[model samples]
Target: MNLETTSSWFLMAAFVLYCAAFIGFVLAVTGRRWADRSPEQHQRKWGWVSFGISAAGFGAHLAFFFTRWAAAGRIPTSNMFEFMTFLAMMTTAAFLIIYALYRSPVLGAFAMPVGFVLLAYAAVFPQEISPLIPALQSHWLMIHVTTAAAGEAFFAVGFAAGLMYLLRVVNFKPTTSGGRAQVFFVELTIFTVLAIVGFVGTVFTFKGAGYEAVFLQEKSSVDQKGQLTTTEETVTYTMPPIVKPYNSEMVRMTPFLGMKEPLFETPSWMNGVNAGRKLNTVVWSLLTAAIMYAALRLILRKPIGAAIQPALDGMDPEDLDEISYRAIAIGFPVFSLGGLVFAMIWAHKAWGRFWGWDPKETWAFITWLFYTIYLHLRLSRGWLGRRSAWMAVIGFVVVMFTLVGVNLVIAGLHSYAGV
Candidate 1:
């Protein structure tokens, strides 16, 4: 097989292994929860087996990453598809490190699914290799994006640990308002997870459906007098048009819904085709979430979190809380060094300026600031337990927005994020 095809096979193989790992981790958690004390030893055995499966998957994932890098003739960090795959791999790596330190099969139960979902999500994006853009053609691209993804992977581990801590700490009955809020968040997490998985399934199922939307795209050309002039033209897209160049006249079409309207521009700072696609993708996620929620309710007859809550009983919430906190503490400096410091240096080298406040840059900075606050609040301000866990969870959200949302929702100087 050629490089792209070969890399794809490796990627598919890795995903299959991830699926097996996910199954193993799930069994590890559920088996321990329901087993008698005598069978508890069996739980330990299952946990080791689960760890082995994920470790093997990690090896496969690593190979898949390098194959893509070789095919691209550069580090695979230039687009959403590439970075998502890289991020998933890093998250797996982070989980393995944490397991080595903490020896918690529980973390694997939560963390491996995050990586698998991300890998599945990455599959939805077009994966064709392309020539590097001028701004992205630098060795610094590898240094900056790879490091940032590594930091986010640590943050992902923190999120999974924080999530487990919350599930353990939150009262299942939730008679009080604060307790109710925690329960809502737990349910929201379930919703979001199922929705993301559904998104991958739904997007691919309808991949060839030709869901077209039109936009008025603005254009500029030099006039006969050697002056610049701007013009608008109607354009159509097979997906949602989130952001676009200035003054594009896009006509919106959704025959399935029997809706058509004039598509307007997003804020000049934010408008782009990818932005609309991201929004549309969210709609699909929600739809899938609702359907899955209904089916789950029919089968289990309760909120999904309620089913998992018993499995969390007697687990050390404090340990999970600390692990989550420590992961972020470790990740923050790495993020700052790569996402901010190296990013600025690369930007100055590539664009002749260091701090343009592009949308992606702004979000990255916002993410950094949020995590900094999380650290300060916990380390110095005495936050702990549920509050600290929640902070870690929110901090990871900021990281996700930096990694995924900014690329999809905003048009910025960092244009390499989109295909």
Candidate 2:
């Protein structure tokens, strides 16, 4: 087979291996009660086994990366699919490093699912390797994107560790208002993860079923000579349309669940060809997440957080807190180098300015500042345990918004990366 096809197979293999590693990790954490095996021995044996599988998966992932780069004649991070997969790979690398130091199977239980979600999210985007645009042809593209994604991957690991810390420490059965508030936020965090899973599941389900909708959007713009130009752009949707693009006519729509057409038009202020489609995807994700959550509630007959608390009974909360802090500490300087320093250098070469305050640039700055505050508060202000964990969780949210939300919700020079 060609290198491109081989790369695809390797990526698929890496994904399968990662899934298997997650199962192994889960077994390591939860299989202590198995007959005839000492709990410590069982966990130790399975932890090493799971870590081996994870390391092998990371090897496969690297093979896919380099092979695809060779086949494409460029780094494979030019678009959403390549970038997201790279992020997933980097997250695995970070997890492996942290796991080596800590030898904690619980970390694997949390971190592998994160890698799973990122890889699945990458699959939602187009996978074709296209030539770089003029603006993206510089070596800085490799330096800047890869390094920044690497930094973010460490932050992802920090988030996973932080989340595990919270799950271990939070009081599920609350007596006071503060305890209840903590429960709410923790559950909300879990719900957000489920929402992302719902999104990936929903996209793939409809895509595999061949569901489609199409629209013709009329866009009005002013030319340099002050002439008004109206253009028609075709917007396609792979999921049934809950809403159509603003000021657009439907070309065709496949019926879904007794809905023949979009239920409403996108708001005129949304202001992008695919804005309506993105909004619809968000709606569907939330809907699916709710359904899944409700089903889980029925099956477990308790709040998801309460149900999960038992699995973490023997974990050391302090160790989890330390791992979360250490991961973020390592990621902080890396992020500063790549997201700020290298980005500024690339901006100067490409756009003749280092600080344009573009949406992506602005958000990247915000994310860096947020992490800076996190480190400062933890070190100088005595924020530890619950407080530090919350900061780690919130920090990843900022990183993700900078990476994904800024592209989808706002337009700027880096919008090309969104595709």
Candidate 3:
């Protein structure tokens, strides 16, 4: 088999191993009180077993990365599919390092799913190894992207630990107003994650069903020579169109559940083909998330947060809080080097400017500043425990928005990364 095909098999193997390891970690944390074995021994034995499996998975993931790099004749971090896989791998690597220091089964249980979801999310995009555009053909592609992803992986680890900390400590019933607000925010965070997972499932479901919608749009662009060029482009959607491309004509659409056409045209302000598709995707994702959340609520007959709180019963809130803080602390400098410093240098090299206030650049700086505040507040302003954990959680949201949302909502020089 070709290296490209071999690399895909390796990635599939890594994903399967990660899933199995997540189950093992969950058992390690949640099944410790079982009568079959001593709690300490069960925890210790399964923790090692899970860690070993996760490490093997990481090795397989590394093989996938290297083989893909060799097949593509460039670093694989040049596009969405490649970057997400790398990010997932780095997240697992970060979890392994953190687990070695603390031997925390709960961390593995939480962190492993983050990698799993990311790897799955990567699959949503096309996996073909296309040649990089001129803008991305630089040594800096590997240096800047990989380091930034490694650092963000730690932040993702921190988010997992912080989420566990909240699950351990937050009151489920929440009689008081403040307690109710805390419960709301925590549940909101969980729902957001569900939405992303739902988004992936929704995409694949329609894709597998061979759903198709086509729109023809006219695009106007100004060339470097200051001439206006008009072109007709065909945009296709795998999902049923809730909104068609702005100012575009429908070429064809297969009926879905008796819906023969789009509900409306996307607003003129949201003119790009990608923007319309993205907005429609957001609508479908939220709907799917609601259905999934309702199903879970009905099955459990309780709030999701309350159901998860039981697994975290014996875990210490303070330890989780500390782990979250330390993970971010370690990632901060690495992010500084990759997300800010090296990024600026590469931007200068590529665009002949260090900073252009592009959407991605602005968001990257904002992410750095947000983390900077997290560190400062924890160190100088006595924001530890619950407060610190909340910051870690919110910081992760900022990081994700920087990574994903900017591309979805805005167009700029970094638009290529979104594709």
Candidate 4:
């Protein structure tokens, strides 16, 4: 098979393995009773099996990336889909590194799911050949994009850990009976259910609705050859119809009245710009609002326990929190050097400017700032445990914007790969 075809197969395999790993991780966490009843030999065997599966998936991802690079005759960091693939790979690599140090399988529970989502989203875009523009042809493209993505991957892991920390803090009492454990389990279930429903709602509302074209008319009077002539110009707006209720794609498109030509037949560049604008204004706003609402709810919820308590019978909250901090610290310098400095250097060489305030660049800066603040808060103000955890969670939003939102929702010069 051609390299592109091989890469596709590899990605497919990686996605399947990631899904299986996620299931295994969840089983390890929630099915503790079964593990407890099993022999020690059985637990050790399953742990090795889980790690092997994850490692195999990571290896497949690496092959997929390298094959794509070979096929393209250049690096595969130009577009959203490629960027996401890189991000998934980085997350796996970072998780493995952290696991080597801490031996915490709990982290896999979140990392695997996040990685799966990223790879799945990467599949949305067309996997055809991506012709390199002159600006993206430099060697710096590889270093800049890869390192930045690696840093973001670490932050992604931090986000998962922070979330788990929050759940552990708000619901469970470390020293008490199973009351806290029950609460933690219930909260996790609720979060899972809501995530599923929201995903279904978004998919049905957005993707299920087919594309439509809208038009506007403008009239102007002008003097032509000593006579007054009235002219009417029609402007066209094209997008998928908006779904009203959850998962409803039955919205009717407005009839196309008098117009010079169809709106959507304009070049692919114009289509991308238009779609980017719509996503920036409409979709992003709703997402921001939803996130703010969730944050507020989390803040208002009373903590069921005070002071740092063991996450589980033998797990110390301080150790988990420290690991989280270390993860953030390691990720920050990588982000600074890779996402900001290297990217700026590459941008200067390619686009004749160090910083263009392009959407991708802007979001990368945002991600850097978020983490900078996170580090600052952790050190200067001595914000550890829950506060630090919250910052870590917020940092993921910035990372997500940098990784996915900029490509999907914002128009810029880096709009080569299919998002």
Candidate 5:
């Protein structure tokens, strides 16, 4: 059928399927809890039901993506929304594989919500039906972007597991019941809750108090007319020393500040878009700060009692730590080969350079370095278990910067992937 018709249908189907998968994950967590008190038959029944629902949801999600690609007559990684969908699919697939191997439904309980949030974020932006730009019209576009997305998906899972390990280790004690599993579950819950709160707050702040403007200032300079005069010059005019806007309110709030002044402006066509995004960022930052403060207060209220109780019983700390390390071992190579090596190859072919210090490229290198150090620490420094888990957490933070922070905060060749 028509592109619009097909795209709309696919978007709707993807949303419904993701919601279904999220519910299935929640049910699976509930079933795991019930396994302790309920009959074996009931536990197995719910487990099977949960698996089937997730499987079906994942199938629908894949179909929606492939159909969109077919309708567009090209690969679907040209923009932020499509990239999000692709990443969500890859993450779900990876989570399912891990679940199959380890038989840990708890991973799904954490991963599905993250996938859902990303898909929902994708839906917030309008999907444009346009031909790929010449730079992205090559086959490597598919290979490079898809592989990078897969690597990102794996890192996302690693992040979830590492966070779980951290919570378990920090609250360690020798006598509490289900302490291991409880710590894992609590960590997942706290991460999910904070993410949601942060996202919502960002949406509200950007919607309420965001502004867009193009600032200009007078500078001491000689014009082309050959007479020296202080006159209004466009921000792009750099030969006579850049003009600096004097309004403190504007200077303080401008998002593209350099050492001397703001270097970019929100063009008329993009003013609303930039303002909205800025507002979202501010709101999310405030919300995150608030959640962190509240969590600290709650933790301090009964510090020893609260911390020592949940980590008393459950899985072995060493086992959890080992799992975290193993997951990173599997993901790190993929990230290096896909996000770095292949990306450079594509850049060389498309831009006549192997490396250009693009923001995306820089962040990718940072992520690679972060994980390389993690591996080194584990192998050479005799760091394992808790220390290794902490490294994995930090590595994932670097991965996040590579995947999201660079795209959002820095402008470069990969700007197309930001909304």
Candidate 6:
């Protein structure tokens, strides 16, 4: 098989292995053991198994990546799909490193699921191989984007550990530290993760199903003779419909949901067929995830975090908190080098200026600022424990917004998002 086909098979196999690792990790933690005594031998044994399997999966993930790199003739970080997979890979590699340091099996239990969800999130994007765009055809694409993504992956580890700290330290009931907001975000994070899972399932289940709709784009032009002429362009998607013509006179060729008029028209620049379809897919994904979440809550009769708290009893809240901090400390400078410094170098090469305050660059600044403040608060201001953990969580959210949100919502030179 060609490298592309072989890498795809490896990717599929890695995902399957990750699923097994998640299950094994969950089983290791929640296996029937007495709370009064220390963790059972079987629990620890299973934890090793989970780590080994996850490591094996990471091997396949790396193989998939290198194979794709070989096939593409560049590092596979130019697009959202490739960047995301790299994020998953980095997160897993970071988790393994942390595991080596802390030897906390349950931490793997925590971090691996986030990695799994990241892979799922990556799957939501188009996976076909394509030629690199002009701006991305540089060695810096590897140096810049991959380093930034790797840094974000460490933050993902912080997120997992920070989540564990919350589960261990925070109370769902009212507290002086604005506990209600914490409770809500904690729950939202759970939903978001499950939402990612729901999105992957929804997307993949319909693979090979050539479902599509079309929208019309019209341009009115004035000739040198002062006569006006209008031309129409057709856009199609295998995904759901999102944007439509603003003019009431122009209707959708495919009347999705039986609505002739759209809720609002997309701005001409932001109205690319693929972009609009991706947005619509996002809406469907959230709706699907919401339904799944509701059904899950109905069956469980309690918040998922509360349910998982019991299994987390053996893990130290302080250690979890510290690991989150260490992850950021290690990742921040690398993030600065890759996400900011190298990016500025590329910007100078590509745009003839260091910065234009474009949405992606702006958000990258915001992300860096958030983490910088996090370090400032921790080091200079003596902010530690729950507050630090919360900052860690918020920082990763900023990172996420930079990674995907900018591409989805904002239009700019770098907003192509690997498609």
Error of 5 at 173 (Å): 9.7
Q: Runs in model 2 with CA error above 4 Å?
A: none
Candidate 2 per-residue C-alpha lDDT over 1-419 given as tens digits, one digit per residue, 9 for 90 to 100: 99999999999999999999999999998998773688888999999999999999999999999999999999999898999999999999999999999999989999999997899999999898899988788999999988899899999999999999999999988899999999999989989999999999999999999989999999898999999999998999999888788889999999998999998887777653267788788788999999998999899998898887777888899999999999999988998999999999999999999899998899999999999999999899999999999999999999888877776577688888776
- For model 1, residues 90-136, the per-residue Cα lDDT tens digits are 99999888888887777888998889889988887778898888998
Q: Relative to the true structure, how large is the alpha-carbon lDDT of every model?
A: 0.79, 0.91, 0.91, 0.65, 0.63, 0.79
lDDT of 1: 0.79
Q: Give the TM-score of candidate 1.
A: 0.88
Worst 10 residues of 6 by lDDT: 244-253
Q: Is candidate 1 or candidate 4 better by lDDT?
A: 1
Best by TM-score: 2
| TM-score on alpha carbons, each prediction | 0.88, 0.98, 0.97, 0.72, 0.72, 0.88
Clashes of each: 19, 0, 0, 0, 5, 1
Tell me the spans in candidate 4 whose CA falls farther than 4 Å from its real position.
36-44, 172-240, 243-272, 276-314, 407-410, 415-419
Task: Compose the digit string of candidate 4's lDDT tens values, residues 335-367.
Answer: 899999998999899878999898778877887
Off by over 4 Å in 1: 33-37, 208-270
What is candidate 3's lDDT per residue for 1-419, written digit by digit as tens? Answer: 99999999999999999999999999998888874889889999999999999999999999999999999999999878999999999999999999999999989989999999999989988899898898888999888998999999999999999999998899989899999999999989899989989998999999999989999977778999999999888889999999887767899999988999999877666632287888888889999999999999999998899999998877888899989998999999999999999999999999999999988999999999999999999999999988999999999999988888887777888888777
Better of 1 and 2 by lDDT: 2
Q: What is the lDDT of candidate 4?
A: 0.65
User: How far is 212's C-alpha from truth in model 3 (Å)?
Assistant: 1.1
In TM-score terms, candidate 2 sits at: 0.98
Clash pairs for candidate 2: none
lDDT accuracy of residue 216 in candidate 5: 47
After aligning candidate 2 to the native by TM-score, how far in Å is the CA of 187 from where it should be? 0.9
Angstrom error at residue 167, model 5: 2.3
